[model samples]
Target chain A: MNMTTRVSRLRGDRVTLAHGGGGRAMRDLIEEVFTDVFRPPGREDQARLTSEALQEAGAQLAFTTDGYVVTPVEFPGGDIGKLAVCGTVNDLAVGGARPLWLSASFIIEEGCEIALLRRIAATMAAEAEAAGVRIVTGDTKVVEKGGCDTLFVTTSGVGAIPPGRDIAAVNIRPGDVAIVNGVLGDHGATILAARGDLALSTPIESDCAALGHLMEDVIAAAPGMRAARDLTRGGLASALNEMAAEAGVTVELSDEALPIRPEVRGMCEILGLDPLYLANEGRAVLFVPEAQAEAALAAMRARPEGEGAAVVGRAVTAGRIPVVTKTAFGGTRIVDMLVGEQLPRIC
Target chain B: MNMTTRVSRLRGDRVTLAHGGGGRAMRDLIEEVFTDVFRPPGREDQARLTSEALQEAGAQLAFTTDGYVVTPVEFPGGDIGKLAVCGTVNDLAVGGARPLWLSASFIIEEGCEIALLRRIAATMAAEAEAAGVRIVTGDTKVVEKGGCDTLFVTTSGVGAIPPGRDIAAVNIRPGDVAIVNGVLGDHGATILAARGDLALSTPIESDCAALGHLMEDVIAAAPGMRAARDLTRGGLASALNEMAAEAGVTVELSDEALPIRPEVRGMCEILGLDPLYLANEGRAVLFVPEAQAEAALAAMRARPEGEGAAVVGRAVTAGRIPVVTKTAFGGTRIVDMLVGEQLPRIC
Candidate 1:
């Protein structure tokens, strides 16, 4: 098939089993799909690995692993392949680890066209390169039809954490400022839109990207920052709740200061889903001493990934639970850690 | 509720959402149904953090992770909890790693009774202890009902490989002998029976157990062994195929030498499933050099876990494909990796 013909056919729908197999169909899927999306960056930025092992080792190493079982594998903005790599690299960066080597394992349903599997692998390899991570080892297994959806990816990453750095959500103290790297709920909303169940209108695409460089700058600006965690499965609200629970202190998020894109807010309102409980594939919440909040915010703004970075809340000793403001009415309310998945099959 | 009354209510039934919530209902379900059936020594075998870390760094480390979504959470012989711990640990052990710490993450459907969640966790903790492994960290999340079944478990394990030992399937030579640690297909058969289809009447329970000590013995006895792998989701047939493909050799087996419980064989026949393709959570396969095969077999025989160890096959260089089995009818045929899952959600 001609390049244009293949590209047209590939972009028209959700991913099928053929997208993962290692064959010709796989190649077309990668070139027409991932390569066109996650191209190399045009900026220079510092990267760090942030897991406990790297934090204590006084060395730079990136370590991350993520599983993806997103239904309708291909979505409006991305697919499982892109999410898997970005997810791992982002974890490494937020943990002060440098994005490095990655290993991917695929559990493909049987009769999945080999061409499709290859495409996903190729797309994954390309995304790894975009995020500056290398694909080193891989495994593939075929499950009988109905054993799984189309495919599931499990990725493990190894990166080097920089020296002389310590960061953890548990380190936050009363008066520490909570700075979000960027806007919220874009990914969750974008995915919901692609599902077409809500029948909502408005442009929304997943905010999926690597944040290693953004973290490096903020850490450099405020080396003594209290903590950092990627606001993922639980979103900003859930992330704050976990920090509060772990640190044994209440966290108060300012609704007025929180950053939510207009499109995301509109969708959340219409869908009856709280943006606070939504998910994000590429965003982080950092706790910094109030004095350094401005410097940290400025540092975040200086990076490509942190253009929308802003101070949204503060850690407190009162309340004994996570609390947030109702942006519309200025009403105070509980920002509970997501007890159950509002949407399962999310990354 | 009285023990008899509660027991009668739970036997051979479907799991409800309330069973997974972390509440009073969750507690009762665990205590009444699961704990009553799969209680480990002191009920400590379930997955629970034992300490800050597990084991001192020594030899190499073997690590593996598995996600379980087996249908019918509660089975006749074992359940998802027991299978999750034992399966991952077995993978590490067969790879020459002394299993150490385990990390568990659970996804519970909303409204799942808390009692069921506790039971699964308790079962996991007890099983972990039985295998001499510690669960160091865990995370739990709830998903909307129908987003997943009642529950799903993802377990990751770390184990230390003994020093001065090298085992890789590629090391297998033309004359290397292949021995199985125990009987096959009990676990798969029991799961099939639990499905209540085909009017199957097998009383076979899963043969799931941790096989670390057994591996240590074999490694010590046959220092020059080629490689080892536990037969799990894809059964001995697929594992041997992977080894053959990786090592660039062919494996030949005799039907007469393979170990299978009569119940398991009968179940396989009735269900139209091949025992070779069915999973075995408790068993392992060792490829030893011809000169050390006898020693390896003797060592395996001494271990309680390996009491049924038997030499079932040999590796040959002349064959192109990885697997071949001689039938009871005196004919040889290719035994390929299963095309798809024979028993979905097996491990």
Candidate 2:
């Protein structure tokens, strides 16, 4: 397959309705911008994949999907393409699966710059390569101007879970220790400032990184890991509350022990917002047996993506509230699920 | 697991930004509308799947994806949700895979009615059940009112292909028989009329149907099937051209043998369009060895979705033109790929 010849066939600087019409133009754009970078095996309608892990006796297939419509398609640390890949990878990784294959579908509004699309595709290719996942199959659709924002991406992934790896919120025990991989709210804070809606500028960049490798290491260190959840939309507060409810226990967080950057904290205070509820793309909370807490933290700290790992909380017997935080001021406060929109399109 | 209480928590008449904010509103909407209908096994970030087919010694996994942004959101025969499900299923079916699991991601515009969303979700549920595939995992994002049209759906699917079933265009050989399951251009014609831009009205409905069972039956009958392609975006002409190019053979279509409705033909003539270039969602082109062509046709005719199946063309020795049509007027003409948009967002 001579990609050069195929890519040379593209004749436009911007996307038009023709690029999504299932015609020559559409083929040219897809082959040049996507397949050229991803290099899928065949031109077949579906990608045919084979993996030894899939044939394992008790391997379970893990499937996940996410739609990315973040405002300002490109941000300081990452673009929507990067988020699309990392978000789906984390969804599978947090489930105790070895992330493998991804499928990306793009919905582009007419008149979007072709160069921008190429950049997004390139970022996706780079992210997939870094995470050791193959982008196998995809689709593209074009809508008239005003039919959609510049572009939106939806990525779906499939992975394999080894036998006896039963990771779920219900498996969390009362004595389980909750650990976080990094500082919270970096992504949310960056996006809020990037949007320029509040005229507040900060040097924060999105903490958007793939956690597959970090997760694999943590599981290896803590063989009895109970559950893990990515701190995406709704941040740490929502995740802790859900985990507590599922296990019918209470999660108590130590405010001082929680890893939060001063810049993020300052931004939260100025906006009268709770940092715990701000989103983070690269952070996740893991529950492990109390004995393995140190080992889990050590494993996480050994990785660049988890260098800020810390123990923030622990599960206790059922109480009046599912989650509570012990404040630095020597008082405990209930932390409940967010009731309304705090930050839309934070992801 | 008691869905009644979860559903009772929803409190809204229309979708707001909060429903997508990863808060209580988002949880209520997802649980009541999507999870309740799809019934994914667990609340984990990913769906854990296990299948005996996946464990077969030499089986391969088939993956495909598609994004649907058809205008009007609803047409006579289907809505965006139905198209989202069937489009991905046919993509896998054409690859000779037994479609099994699908993940649907939705990009919704704010201010959309909750009642309409329920209708769309219900339609997707019904379609997946009929296709014998599970809606295993999904994600939803909401944008501001002008960020997108009412809604767009992207569906990615995985299936299993038994060993030695290498159905691909490159496998096609000269003298292979070509067949189509049903009418061409019904979907395109229906959408055009439904758009109300041409001041035309017709009883024509979109031919949106899942062909997984039909493909399975045909494969069983004709074990020597060469290749199959869903006649979607660019219709039969484009599919035939692609197959011909891949196999280095010439495809000759008999104009009189094509299964086209009178309404579609009339509409095409009035609008200066070619029926061969119009899209069909429920139709597919299949190639099989001459010996098993009769069995393949018989198997297709036995199914309701393929009752209108007919032999329409054949592959011949390589020629100057990859695709040509034998007109009823006793002359042959080149059938080139569509150069520009005939119909956008038809699917």
Candidate 3:
């Protein structure tokens, strides 16, 4: 753990094939930039982990992984590093697991700036700390220029789920209230603007925060919570459809009750996009029994990451379609799963 | 898992941005190609795992990750998918853990052939099944054409280490014996030939195989085994140097006793490469007490993956350098860590 003793041995400002050759250069880059920031417990090839949570009787391990290939490595509110950590963390959290440990592997293109990598590592470290997880093991590989985009990160996480807590889409029941944590499409809108392809400006930042803590709070308030899905790539619409299909129920959404930022709405309108299917990194739809809906909403609203909490829909008895939205004018329309790409590399 | 119930709904032969957008296309590709092949237990974002091994008192978890970006997605005797699984599994096995589960994430280029992806997935499934592990969770991201090579895969693994077993380089003693499972450099040589840059064809095939069962057999025979390291990117020389440095001892190898093929030796000589530094995907250097060395060798030689097992060297008192070799001519020479790239993306 004496990181200071391993002074910078890197000789160049950018990555090279040698840095991934399992040689002195690779060791130098890993030690100075990665190990120094992440501070894992050992230099072993694999991390040894033990926790009281794992020792508990009937405890289950939750494992998930995500690959981050965002267009711009660094975005307004978060970089690929933060997104990688948060995305994996949220995946675990939504499954009702206490996010614990993560392993991050980076595929860096040769000639990528060393400074940028350091920044990304720092951001990953900060985000992991805030999320109460340790990045215990990692690997780095440098590909030749043009072999890959600047950098891509794949983070896999392991969490512990307490005994008797079964949360899954199949557990969702009719009459369960669906709640969203915040306004949708901020992340998608932010990335669209950041790419500068649309030639429009906006003061929007990605809502790319980790939701483990918020989930813990809501679970505490509503023990009857059935399931939760992070509104990520396919957004709320896709999540709802999947949940409905799995539970063999129907999801009815109150279109007017959906919370969306003015800028995101404007961007969707200008681009002829439906805000319902736009991705959101930090948003999720939670299904709680009707009796505890108010408690879940209040618990979510109490957290900064969930200040925009609102009840957007409910699960009803099976109908012709999986998901439908009731408009402000009183008519209902199918809100199907996204058919094709509206935006690529949004995560 | 009722995989047959979900028939293929794929529309095209090539992957497009729509297949990575978390929509219907993505679902179709994942279900028909990935989920049907892997047959995970659930459709949730994370896998819920429970095992008697994890519930044991004093048991510890082992976690590791690696990114595979070998130049040719498909190489002689193996593809990136097979390499990805074996690399991570070997990392955990060498740490004295029984690898239990794996999470695979792929960054695939747009327009990549779907048929090729199916082949990779099938290979991964077969390998995981042979290794006694499950590919329980995964993610896929599609990058724009030219944003990445045809494909890159990153795999993370979780394993269980029973109580009282601590295998690490730091455990090496002055008299520990070093043994290798087989000949070195076949994987590196095979990749070099597969790339066709040298236009030199040889009968060499990549020695890529999972070594978890082999390690288990060795440990059962030699309970006092000190450490084990997979001879991966930097091969035997680098692994020895690392072990020597960590244990504060010197490693002395008998150059006459090194097991290497004639074709590999010729390839190394022609390319000005050192076979000692050439990578091996299925080989490992194991350290055992002198008394247990014979037992370890017998156990390894009994396995198909380790039929070429041989005593390569022994740890000795600290010398001027961390690693050295005794030549056939009875002269000693230092064998330091590799300094730079010998073969890029040799994985």
- For A1-347, candidate 3 gives per-residue lDDT tens digits of 44455456798799999999998999999988999899997878999999888679888999999999997999899999999999999999999999999999999999999999999999999999999999999999998999999999999999999988988999988999999999999999999999997898999999999999999999999999999999999899999989899999999999899999989999999999999999888999999999999999999999999999999999999999999999999999999999999899898
Tell me the lDDT of model 2 at A48: 96
Give the per-residue Cα lDDT of candidate 1 at A121: 64
Give the lDDT of residue A344 in candidate 3. Answer: 90
* Pairs that clash in candidate 3: none
Q: How many clashing residue pairs appear in each of the predictions shown?
A: 65, 0, 0
TM-score of chain B of each: 0.82, 0.98, 0.98
Tens-digit lDDT track for model 1 on A1-347? 33553325453344443443222233345445433433322110001111344333345333345566666677766778878788777767776667655555566664555456556666787778778776544434444465556677766555555565556666778889888989998888877777777687658777777777787788888888888888766578766766777777787777888889888888787767788767888888888999888899999988777889988888888574565555557777877655533665656
Error of 2 at B107 (Å): 0.9
Q: Return the TM-score for each candidate structure.
A: 0.76, 0.98, 0.98
Q: Write the per-residue lDDT of candidate 2 for residues A1-347, one digit (tens) a residue.
A: 44454337878699999999888999988998899888887889899999888789889999999999998999999999999999999999999999999999999999999999999999999999999999999989999999999999999999999988989999998999999999999999999999998998999999999999999999999999999999999999999988889989999999999988999999999999999999999999999999999999999999999999999999999999999999999999999999988988877
lDDT of 3 by residue, B1-347 (tens): 34455445898799999999988999998888889899887889999999778778888999999999987889888999999999999999999999999999989899999999999999999999999999999999998999999999999999999888999999999999999999999999999999997999999999999999999999999999999999999999999999899999999999989999999999999999999999999999999999999999999999999999999999999989999999999999889899999888887
Best-to-worst order by DockQ is 3, 2, 1
| lDDT score at residue B19, model 1, on the 0-100 scale | 39
